[model samples]
Target: MASLPNRKIAAAVVREDAAHRQRLLDRAFALAFKGLVYAQIWEDPVVDMEALAIAPGHRVATIASGGCNVFSYLTDDPAEIVAVDLNTAHVALNNLKRVAILHLPDYAHFRRFFADADDAANIADYRTFVAPHLDETSRRYWEGRDLVGRRRINGFARGLYKRGLLGGFIGLAHLVARLHRIDLGEFLAAKTVEEQRAIFDSKFAPFFDRKLIRWITDQRSSLFGLGIPPAQYDALADGKPMADVLRARLEKLACDFPLDDNYFAWQAFGRGYGKGVAAPLPPYLQEVNYAAVKARAERVTMLHANMTDMLAASDAASFDRYVFLDAQDWMSDAQLAALWAEVTRTARAGARVLFRTAAEPSLLPGRLPDALLDRWEYRAEESRDYTRRDRSAIYGGVHLYTLKAD
Candidate 1:
């Protein structure tokens, strides 16, 4: 996997002044992402689309974590979308989604395969329809077995959404909540924001009050399942108690959006999109955009490489939009500068870049060179607007920047 370098880079970010402490933190992050991290992306596609304002003439380069947003971007009808990731598992998964979208007979089967993911028939569908069409790398990944001895593809038949690193983390959260006599799933019955808040205050808020739960959350390794590196944990948990931050985020997840349309809430509370609830499905799975995504599936290209390397090899002014997806939080000052240098070189006029942060402010000012950072104008007002509307409710900030005209 090309992730070793990323792991190394991540490891190096922890200051060595602390000696043993920093090294231990580095190892944890390196080991955490050795396998599949996110079964689905956590970013809100609606907010991303609004921020990027993608047009048919634009070419986009985005990190392909779980690949949901890559397909969602297709709805905007961009000229090209290049999905890149250092994690080979994620790269393979993106390829699988692209191929599945292209090869699935219709929207119904696609929904069955992904949204209603636990049906055993999906195994047959995969073998009969999706598997043969997948590239060798993706085929090998899906066909491969985990520590439990089931092939990864069987996860679809068993509940694809509940199988990855994030899935396991949510499962743990559920178990802990159950131990406290709280049924997290009950939050899904909320019809209005008030009802949602009431349910959360009555049932969910108490889960965080437990000392055991707070201790577990305090540990950085506990968040590895969410693909959060140690550096990100430091940023997220800075001055506040980790449990408090998590409680606030979970509160937002449960109470800020209507349960009817927020698939993220469905995933968090109901585990698997409530079996047949198609209305809350991700944008790609939704019926209205299904045909359009299928038609444009071929336009996506999945690459197994770091974003910096990918951008370095590309033609100058080749791309119009970039989606960093909280990756900047994992980088060092030097690494951030190198990345923005390439981004500045490769971006076309009016190019837009979007990213999320574990912290409230953008990381560019102190970390990136002033000259490089000055080349783009930060859309602070728009970022704040979109951040409020982001249904995922996980990130601290959502940011957008556009290139300054020469």
Candidate 2:
């Protein structure tokens, strides 16, 4: 038998710097990984899978969340991908998955890499097929196994990481309610679809507008774990004293799409692991990505720096597609312009740039001048349809754009 191999660190662990990860997660919102501290993912875009009809050699850059859509997008087989994120843990996970897909030998090994709980065979598989390819930092990262001794990757198998800050917060609230003889999670996890509706209407509906819940959620400190900064907390809390937008978002989580097909709902309330056969999956994670997914692990350059900084690092007329993925909502006028200048410079003329926001309106209109924003044609109808059909989402909307004809 061969010895376990040392892991390789791809750029996916690009933001492994402690200070950078701290600024994003511990400070932004009190989010955790494997019940530790992953970044907050509230109001994240429901990535437009339909819009991801990749050309033969499209180079795409996307935000690396837990790395779901990155794999989803790969199902279309882009030429390359640049997945940037301020969160190191997320980057690490992306690298890990990409490597797993390439190294795991087959789909079953891939399933064991992410969805298999902490079984002896699973751990052994990690040591054999998976661990050898992981970079040193990532190897160490998974070895720590958190305080719970549950390997972080296996947490995905255990359906833990999918439960983001919002998911955990929902769980905490459900627990609080459970103490008072209310079982919010249980009621939502009804065996039948109709019973689930009854629970949503009778049990979960009132909590959306609860004053105490609003008060706690509105506090920046209270949301520290969710990784929202003081400013973002203020923005998300809406202008009123209570959390109106939050209530709406939560209501959407409960009622937007039927829970049967929506994986986000499973993570939020059903506490399910969407790790079965690739059939019931987002586009990126399907079997199409299995064979070639790891090949692009190194191709994508994950960075903690702003998109503008990333643009400065690249050359002109380079990327065929630039996917902003809602990062522009955090930009200032100068920042937006600077980022756009780089995007436009590196753009391959007809290259497309896409993004999303917290509301129906485009954040770029006032922030970015007309000429800069006009370079890309907004696919409003397509964005709307994608947003509506986004199944693995707890958020309300999505947006898309295509760069103008050269």
Candidate 3:
């Protein structure tokens, strides 16, 4: 049987009394999610920061996945940040990042641990500095052995980004590309968008037409590594072949942004971030923003709980910003209403909510109650623009809603 937190994950992901095949996929997703999913979150914080316009003193509530955006948001210096998640591994990862940021001697050590993430010294550093300062839960998780019997902290020494489910998925993708005699790393060498498009056209786009690729992508379980639960998988597919959707997303990832600035492209193509101090990185990992993020690390409080439950227990009109991060796409109609009701109740005046969707349109119009929907203004035009600007290219929509002034 799954543990309590795993059961909570199942409650969120598994629909009740579905067809046998659907139930299997849902259960498989829940089981896969029991371990680390994302080593680095896929959403673009640069786009998020622009959409939210996070000003100083705002209190932000968000789902803490890989802790990338959580720390990046600290650059804006929010008064308080409440990060909630159901995944125990994610909660542990987030807490570990918090303590590491708090106690690591300098930016170099921090960068080496996260950015490089392939040095044996990192395990030593974790024991010497980060582990002692980490909370008991997080410490135990890091020291604990994974299913393969390697300590979780050893991930840092063995290339952390290449170890999670997402990492394994990417590794498989690279393997597939290799079997086709295509090197994904070639995309990273392109200095211009035209070059990227050319490489993608010649190497990647046609690969989707292969029979094995089509068959594999058609199965919803195949995407579990990307953290696409069954519900979101249906939305992402939208009755179209999954290969087409994936190809389109990969096109955007390859050609829509300069490789020099998009670390997401680096991660996808090079299997990790680009080399050296000058490489593109998340804001929290960048040297220029290091001090600000490190200083504000204490402002964040990570919890292993459902977002709605956490909000329900809080005082009304308390939160200023909300970031859902595609989690809402996993919700049913009733769950959507329940979450939005709590969101509306807890939001302060002029509060903003930002979330990504697997589909191009916002999921709220037909799903959320009119009364609750009437109290917020959806920034459709801005959302569309932000969606295009999102360098990650994995999401189809980036919706923003602002609470109407009382």
Top model by lDDT, which number? 3
Residue lDDT tens for model 1, 1-406? 5356466444434545446876687676766676787878999998899889999989999999999899999999999999988777788788888888888788888988888888888889888888888988789989999878889988888888887788888888888778878888888777799999999888878778888878988987788878887778989987888899999998888888888878999888877776554458778888899999999999999987788989999999999999999988988787788899999999999999999998888888877888999899998998899888889998999999999999
Per-candidate clash tally: 0, 27, 0
Best by TM-score: 3
Task: Point out the higher-scoring one by TM-score: 1 or 2.
Answer: 1
Error of 3 at 189 (Å): 1.2
Q: Kindly list the per-residue Cα lDDT of model 3 for residues 128-171, writing each as its tens digit.
A: 99988888988888899999899889989989999889999999
Q: Name model 2 segments beyond 4 Å from true.
A: 1-47, 116-120, 145-159, 162-170, 187-195, 240-242, 274-279, 287-305, 392-396
Clashes of 1: 0
- Model 3 misplaced regions, further than 4 Å: none
lDDT of each: 0.86, 0.58, 0.93
Candidate 1 C-alpha error for residue 51, in Å: 0.6
lDDT of 2 by residue, 40-89 (tens): 23322335545655676888767666666666566566777787765556
Q: Please tell me which model should have the higher TM-score, number 2 or number 3.
A: 3
